[model samples]
Target chain A: MKILIADDSRVMRQIVIRTLRQAGYDDHDIVEAEDGAEALAKVGSESPDLILSDWNMPNMTGIECLEALRAQGSSVPFGFVTSEGSAEMREKAANAGALFLIAKPFTEDTFKEHLDGVIA
Target chain B: MSTTDTGQRRRGSDSRPVITDLMDEDTILAVAGDAWISLVGEDEVLVPIPGEMPGDVLSSWVDVVGPWTGSVVLTTGRATAEALSRALLRESAPEVLDDEDVEDAFGEIANVVGGSIKAALPGPSGLSLPQVGHSPLVRNPADVCRVEVLWRGEPLTISVQGALPPLPVTH
Candidate 1:
């Protein structure tokens, strides 16, 4: 499976990729996008199996990209890996068709808990 | 209604809750502690004891905009910030660290801590991208909640300070 990780911070992108390996999901192909707009563009071009995106970004936000994807009649599985994880944000993500949200400062176990079923 | 009563209503309308009203030092410490364990290391713990900050310091922060507008800032000695960056990068750390590496890694720490802080506050708030440099000035003394802690024997401060000045008193 292919995974698209979208975040403006390159360090965070590296962390997410490293955490994926730590969680034992090292076999899949990984794609990178700097912001939500890039993620949106890559979604059309790369056709990733799943997307893990940061909520806030320059140019466009993850939520905006998700909304746009739904409006375009796309059903790609999407999730958020962000610093903001309030109940309201979680509900907003859910209502927008996100699979799940993994809050930042996450451990390998946290990644495994969320990705075990989704990865396969 | 009396004229004085009308003025009271206006003051009430302008009243905004400060950082202490929403969250306290303990909560900020807890948030920072959890972030440290996850990002720094499992065994790494932040001691709550305060220490004097060195003259040479670096700060990283993210602005939170909502009912409670402020920035979640982390300030520490430059060496400590570099140490933190190295710990975060682990094997990925270049033999010689660059300014960009420290800024990116340190900014991310603020991002995580600020994100967690935002969640604890009232809903629908926006989080800004993290920045690294001098700390932002505290707009209102009463609008701040700061916690000082020690990580690896180095002093670090986490300050949640308001972006706006205190509401004018309608006396």
Candidate 2:
């Protein structure tokens, strides 16, 4: 499976990738995008199976990317790994067609809980 | 006689609520403690006791703009910042870390902590990209919510301070 990870922080992107491995999802191919705009473009170029994105990013935000994808008629599975996980943001994400939101400072266990069926 | 047509007493433009009014020290501590455990390490604990920061301190922060407009500043010694960078990098940490690596890693911590704090406050707010350098100045003493804690026996302080200077006190 190809998974696209979008985040402005190089360190955070590393952490998310590491945690995915720790959650025992190491077999999937990983694609990296530094911002939502890149992630949006890569969604077409890379054709990733799933997208894990940060909510706050430069240029287009993760939500904006998702909205664009939906507008373009792409039905890609998407989730958020972001610092902001307020109820309002969560609702906004859900309304935007996001699968789930895993707030930052997450553990491998948190990843497992969320990614169980989604990854397989 | 100067009141607007609506007739309600016009609140001064400077009447914006401070950080303290939105959230207290205990709430900030809880948020920081959870962030430390999740980001720093599983067993890492943040002691609530206050510690004196070293003279050569570094700060990482993210700005929160909305109902409350300010920055969530995390301050600690340079050595501690490096240590934290190493910790975040873990096995991936290089033999020697440069300034950029520390800045990125340290700023991320503030981002996570600040994000959580932003959620706790009244929202529809926007969070800026994380920044690392000297901390932002405290615009209003009454608008600050600061907490000092010891992490691995190192001193660190988190300050949620407003960016705008205090409104002039009306006579």
Candidate 3:
């Protein structure tokens, strides 16, 4: 399966990629996008099995990107990885059709617990 | 030239009193653990330097205004900043980092750590966005409180001036 990871910080993107690889997803194709706009553009061209996105970005937010995709009738699995994981934010993401929300400062275990069922 | 101007100058000079009341090294270490564990990739151990300033590496300056009036500045050697970036990015240490990139990375680190600290403080206090300075020397007044701590043996200088509510007052 192919996975898309989107975040503004290159460091964070690297961390996510590393965590995903460590979680035994080494066989899947992994792609990256720097911001939400780029992510949406990529989605238009190269549809992936799932998307892991950061909430905060320059051009558009991850939530905004999700909404845009859903509005266009695309239903690929989606999730958020962000710094602030307030309850309200989770509800908003869920309402917007996001499958899960992962807070920052997370470890590989945390990622697996939240994402394993969804992806596997 | 005027009394008001002189008073302003004096206040500025006395803004951040040399922080003699040091933060408990253990407490700061715990906070670092909470904030940097994932980013750092392993358990962090603190190393103590008997007489070194924290800002000796990753040097940058930012003015903290509003409830507090003074600057929160961090200075470090160039090599140290690169090392930190590599650790955070989980990549091999780069040969060098541009001045602006170093400042941006350092500023973001300060913002994240400082914001966490402020949230844990007793009352409301606001943290402004961080500013960066490349100069090795920082011109903070003698009175400012400078807390020097080592993160995994890397010197991290945290200086603060003016006490405000631990949380921001929404008025």
Candidate 4:
């Protein structure tokens, strides 16, 4: 599966890639974008199988990106990897049609557990 | 010496345990490792300050208000700031990073760390944006509650203020 990882932090993007590899997704193609706008452009060209995005960013936030994609009728699997996982945020993400929400300080095991149900 | 003896020796001399004991060791280690890895990957090192640090290093200071109250400042040295800009651009570390670029990087780091720490804490806490400072020195002592501890070998500082009452305080 091709996955697009979007986040503003280079460290964070590397960590997510590391986690995904550790979670047995070694064969999966992983693309990266620094912010939402870049992510949208990548989405248009690459058409990834899944998207893992951060909530807060400089140009465009994850929610806005997701909404934009959905508005354009794209239905690729989507999830969030964010620091704040409040119920309100979760509800908003769900309302926006996100499949999962993974909070920060996550581990390979946790990512597997969350992604297994969706990807499997 | 045995492992127990070494552990005891390490834990005994350490007076402050709020950050060390309260949070799991692996979590802290991961954070430190990630931070160091990020900085090093960009070819930046924690260098010692030379004579007369720059004035525009730290632009602002914000109090971490919640169960714990302390101040977090954002500052950057000449080399460090330059390194940060190059890292952000995914380019090689520049010989010199512009002052504005350094300030932006400092603020961004503070924001990332502060948000991560706040999320790790037990309860909800309020975080302020990074404040830019002209002077490299942190002027207000009262704002700084606690310094980061040296866990394992790396330095980790955490400061807290008084707990908030059950109800919100009306100004």
A76 Cα displacement, candidate 1 (Å): 1.8
Tens digits of lDDT, candidate 3, B16-117: 323234334455445545556766666754444533544344555444333334444555566666666667765543566666556556655554455444
Off by over 4 Å in 1: B1-12
CAPRI class of candidate 2: high
TM-score, candidate 2, is: 0.93
- As for DockQ, the candidate ahead, 2 or 3, is 2
Instruction: Name the candidate that leads on DockQ.
Output: 2
lDDT digits (tens) for residues B76-125 of candidate 1: 99999999999988888899999999999999999999999998998578
The regions of model 4 sitting more than 4 angstroms off are B1-112, B116-144, B151-154, B159-171
Q: Model 3 compared with the native: what TM-score?
A: 0.67
lDDT of 2 at B170: 62
Q: Model 4 lDDT vs. the true structure?
A: 0.61
Output the lDDT of residue A87, model 3.
Answer: 65
Q: What is the lDDT of residue B161 in candidate 2?
A: 95
Off by over 4 Å in 2: B1-7, B10-14
- DockQ (0 to 1) for model 4: 0.15
Q: List the global CA lDDT of all models.
A: 0.93, 0.92, 0.65, 0.61
True contacts kept of each: 0.77, 0.84, 0.23, 0.07
Task: Residues A70-90, candidate 2: write the lDDT tens digits.
Answer: 999999999999999999999
TM-score of chain A of each: 0.98, 0.98, 0.96, 0.96
